[model samples]
Target: MRAATKENNVRTCLACGAKSDKGALLRFAAAGTIIVPDWRGTLGGRAVYSCLTTDCVARFYTLKRFPEKFFKGTPAFAISQGEIHGWIKTQAEASLAHFLGLARKSGVLTLGQNTLADILENGGTAPTAVLLAADLADRTLREITGIVPVGTPVLRWGTKETIGASIGMRPVGVVALGRSPITDRIVHYCAIVNHFSQEH
Candidate 1:
């Protein structure tokens, strides 16, 4: 459809002090005296937020004050910038791959260069979003961009080899995801990965 919009859960970034959607921010839940990461926001506890920008994430870890204001309580967060970044990055990637596997089982994933080319040239199931491998050929990218549905989010993700491995196939240059909870979560993890690195 269009760009993903914000909902009611707006949080201020602990690092940048900017207001943003919760899904776009990283959440850390309190556990005893440590601020444990709650990546998917699936935990129930006091929490704080930091937007997923490289600068914001860096600033967040360097905070001298624990920002009890944001968390609504004090927890001597036993975490480092490297830990947060690495943990979330690893989790986001593994989660994306896991969801891709689920998509395969659920029958909502489409891949293969020739198959995608044929589908784009002709007609078939409409994709909610399209993912092109990072090392995808420029010629194929040009062809696909010219044919991709307008307003559909197009992202460049893992290398052809990595992307293919995730879905149990040979090297794949492109993949189309259909609308479903699986796709939605894929998009969310994609956001986490992209925004976290910023340059990704």
Candidate 2:
């Protein structure tokens, strides 16, 4: 008898349709089970990797080619359509928080929201990304993005009912103090908050 070869866990890029090792791309798990692209490639769980950039992500979701593996039951089933989007938002926030926290510790970030907005308006400094609480209303990040829409923003997917009771829970942007690595912390926080919201 011949030994079984290792399963080819390598992923193919949805955009260029290029094949590469899993580590080369960002993976995300959608429909609660299937993996897609995490962009930052930091979020935990079963994920299918894809190359960075919105184009690749859009292709993966639009075609829904690989989703068959996880949606085999019930004939016409929808697992978690929002899972991939949620993961992306959470991961982005975590990455920003972590790095910003480090920068804050180093006394690099002296400006808060107002100052940051001012800088953005004046074309002085442009943030790489923005994280907003899902429940937050009257968001100003749009203006920042309009002036420089190239920046990405992470919006909260959980409601206040889920994370309202948590320590310093504010479903908007960074409340106070940045986390070690924004992506890691945001992902972890979203998981906990989402679990509670789903349970009770």
Candidate 3:
């Protein structure tokens, strides 16, 4: 049997603006109090796809687009973004943990202050996203912001131990754009990070 490639299976996440192969993303439906994928895509309803990032899940919730899209014709109860985020977090953390295991083998993964600072100074670029443990949040948030160069949209995930453990990662800081309270924030963050990172 032959394998499918990106060209033939491209899918985009409307929520977080991430693109991937169709098989690489998960689809979710808005029903009752949450946005959830049928996994089989068998459950009938309007659908949205989310990439592996918990941030993407949070984006869907904050935007409040799931129930509106999924239950448009149904008589279901209104769903909250918070509920959707919670569900996504459950999945994302697990995905992140698997990803981390792979990263560990490649020697590209970093932890602690010196490693993170180098990431900040060098402009973080790794095949996998930066994952910090939750306990480091207060210190990492400030350091990340300092090194991240202003105007880079930082997506934050507030933590609980479950989400943290699932990813084998804790909440620290993210310096990327997926969703936004305001589009301009992402735009500005991107511009500033790029501009300053180049200058330094």
Q: Which predicted model would earn the best lDDT?
A: 1
Q: Estimate each model's TM-score.
A: 0.75, 0.35, 0.40
List the candidate 3 regions with Cα displacement exceeding 4 Å.
Answer: 1-7, 10-25, 28-85, 118-129, 132-140, 149-200
Backbone collision count in every prediction? 0, 19, 6
Give the alpha carbon lDDT tens digit for every residue of 12-101 in model 3: 787768788654466766666555564445667676676645556456545633345554543332344445444444444444444334
Worst 10 residues of 2 by lDDT: 70-79
- Give model 2's TM-score versus the native structure: 0.35
Q: Rank candidates, TM-score, best first.
A: 1, 3, 2
Question: How many collisions between residues are there in candidate 3?
Answer: 6
The digit string of per-residue lDDT tens for model 1 on 14-65 reads 8888998787788888777677778778878678888876778777767766
What lDDT does the true structure give each of the candidates? 0.79, 0.47, 0.47
Tens-digit per-residue lDDT, 59-99, candidate 2? 65565355454343332113244454455555554544455
The numbered model that scores best in TM-score is: 1
Any residue pairs clashing in model 3, and if so which? 133-170, 134-170, 134-171, 151-189, 151-190, 152-189
